[model samples]
Target: MSFRSRGPRTVPLKSAEEVDAIVRKIRDDQTRPENYRERSLKLHGWICAKCGREFELSNLHLLTVHHKDGNHNYNPPDGSNWENLCVYCHDDEHSRTILADYLAGKDKKS
Candidate 1:
């Protein structure tokens, strides 16, 4: 008698805590890249992108270091097109897709 069985050639598993920790580390690195904060502030002229008005460094609360091409890791490649979006605009952009889906679902339910 001959038998053949096939399963995944390779499978990797990590505990939930390990996965969470890895994700948290990645997010932390992205949000606080080395020296990115200081360089970006100067590059953006210390102004709110949406308002186009100057603000003190302290007023730069909750500012998002926006990635113009939607590639957060791409690092702008150059300083030209990168922008500093305030929290309001940043959150708006980030939530657009989720908001659309939510609205559509609500509409269907109602």
Candidate 2:
């Protein structure tokens, strides 16, 4: 006897409405900000891209996802725009962005 004869194939059956609901739920979850962060962490691991600091599970919460283009809604499944950064580096990145915007505005007035 082969492996195929050892057991029957099993398939899950669902109504059309049920399948639609499941698909909608999945899409909704994927669009959430938390889901993007989780995906980023998984894609890039727990090292801070900016500071080169590594984290363990105990300190993983200190690590955050940074959107390279500064758009939170631009998350891609391939994590092309995501960077894992520790809290300090993340804050520094945002601070630089803020300063740059302010300087640009000041320059526009001159």
Considering every candidate listed, which one attains the maximal lDDT? Answer: 2
lDDT of 1 by residue, 21-68 (tens): 999999999987556556687777777688666667678676767766
Candidate 1: RMSD over Cα atoms? 14.6
Candidate 2: deviation at residue 101, Å?
A: 1.8
Off by over 4 Å in 2: 1-34, 106-110
- Estimate, for each residue in 1-110, the C-alpha lDDT of model 2 and write its tens digit: 55545578788999999999999999988876668888898899999998899999999999999999988999889999999999999999999988998887853655
Give the lDDT of residue 10 in candidate 1. 81
- The stretch of ten residues in a row with the least summed lDDT in candidate 1 is 72-81
* Model 1 CA deviation exceeding 4 Å by range: 1-34, 100-110
Which ten residues in a row are the worst by lDDT in model 2? Answer: 1-10
Global lDDT of each candidate: 0.72, 0.91
